[model samples]
Target chain A: SQTIHQWPATLVQPVGSPLSLECTVEGTSNPNLYWYRQAAGRGLQLLFYSVGIGQISSEVPQNLSASRPQDRQFILSSKKLLLSDSGFYLCAWISGGNTEAFFGQGTRLTVV
Target chain B: AQSVSQHNHHVILSEAASLELGCNYSYGGTVNLFWYVQYPGQHLQLLLKYFSGDPLVKGIKGFEAEFIKSKFSFNLRKPSVQWSDTAEYFCAVELYGGSQGNLIFGKGTKLSVKP
Candidate 1:
């Protein structure tokens, strides 16, 4: 069975501080990885998605960027965080021939 | 541009009451439909999905949804909802044969079931 691990279940970062949230999947290869932000009343917003290593597609223009360093390791980073950047971030993956997505326990980031 | 619409922003129902959440999408081509659930303080989990074949699909926890192609709607239903079913439900759509990476989601409907 495949599992996704997202770190820092809860984070409190000062404004303008650098940020890095990591997500990695086990038991799967070449899986599609995605980063999503969940906000109050806004539902889930797709921030970035990668189909392979070093390849990322941004859905919204904001203070966040994503990278796929390895086949199953994805990283979301920001040089300087903004107050608006605080939200529940989720990592999800879908393997070949599978349309159903599996999600990891999200990171609740609070930028104060 | 592709978009998804979830009709009910919030719904309040008593235990054992019937439930129905409406979902519709804007896309001309073949597409895939999905329903996800998020309990309090938990990760989003897949409730059900519709790719093809049966228009009606059964999901976990006695949840089911029907896909109506003509109306572009995938409505979720439960015969009798429990208090434990209190959670937010999301409707998502993916363009079939298009970019598999982009899974457009709706704003979501929050369901509150009173015991």
Candidate 2:
């Protein structure tokens, strides 16, 4: 069975601080990885998605950037996070088209 | 741009009560539908999906959803809900409009099942 892991289950950062959230998937190869942010009482917003190593597609224009350093490792980064960037960040992977995705525990980032 | 819409923002029900959550999407061409659940303080988990098959699809925890192509709707249903079912339900649509990497989601419907 495949498992997805996300670190720093909860985080609190001040505005203008840097941010880094990591996501790794085990037991799968060449999987599609995605980063999403869920605001308070709002639907998820796709921040970035990676198809392969060194390949990333950003959805929203924000302070966040995503990178696929390895086939199984994805990283979300922010040089300067804004207060609006505070939300629940989730990482997910899909086997392929029409396949359901598996999500990690998610990182609750609260930017003060 | 593709988008999804979940009709009910919140719903309250009791144990053994029926469940039905509406999910609609805006995208032409072939599409895929999905229903995900999130327990309190937990991450989102896939409950059911509709790709290419019978419209009615069954998922974990006795949850089910039906897809109506003409209506562009995939509604989730459960004959009996439980207290453990108290969670937020999300309707996600995989962009199948002849595109790659879909999974657009709706605002979500928060279901509160009482004991």
Candidate 3:
């Protein structure tokens, strides 16, 4: 069975501070990774997705960026956080040629 | 560009009531449709999906959805809903060979079932 791990489960950072959220998948290789944000009443919005290492496609332009450093490791980063950046961030993985996606326990980020 | 639309933003229903949540998509080519559920404090879980098969797809917890390509819609249904069914439901779409593994999601519908 594959599992996705995301941390920190909850984060509180001051405005203009740097932010880093990490997600890793175990028991799967070369899986498609994605970053999504769920804002209040906005539902889930895809931010970025990666097919392979060093290959990322951004869905929306925002203050955040995503990177796939390894086959199973994905990171979402922000050089400077904005108040609008606060939301519940989720990491998901899907196998190649598979339609169903598995999500990790999201990180609740609060940028004050 | 592709987009998904979920008709109801929120719905309240009594136990044993039927459910019919509407979902529509705007894409010219073949697309995959999906329904995901999220309980409070839980991660999003796949309820069901429609790729290529019989138009009607049944999922866990007595939920089903039918894909009507003619109307570009995939509507979720349940004959009887329980109070435990209260959760957020999302409709998503992925263009065949076009989405790049990204799924476009609709503004989810929050279903509150009263016991």
Best by TM-score: 3
Runs off by more than 4 Å, candidate 3: none
lDDT of 1 by residue, B33-81 (tens): 8999999988788999998999999999999999999999999999999
True interface contacts retained by model 2: 0.57
Task: Show model 2 residue runs off by greater than 4 Å.
Answer: B97-99
Q: What order do you get sorting by DockQ, best first? A: 3, 1, 2
lDDT of 3 by residue, B3-98 (tens): 899999999999999999999999989988999999987889999999998999999999999999999999999999999999999999988887
> For model 2, how does the per-residue alpha-carbon lDDT over B51-88 read when each residue is reduced to its tens digit?
88799999999999999989989999999999999999
In terms of docking quality, model 2 is medium
The per-model lDDT (C-alpha) reads 0.93, 0.89, 0.93
TM-score of chain A of each: 0.98, 0.96, 0.97
Residue B24 lDDT in candidate 1: 94
DockQ for all models: 0.71, 0.67, 0.82
Please list the residue runs of candidate 1 whose C-alpha ends up more than 4 Å from where it truly belongs after superposition: none
- Residue pairs clashing in model 1 are none
Candidate with the greatest DockQ versus the true structure? 3
Model 1 lDDT on a 0 to 1 scale: 0.93
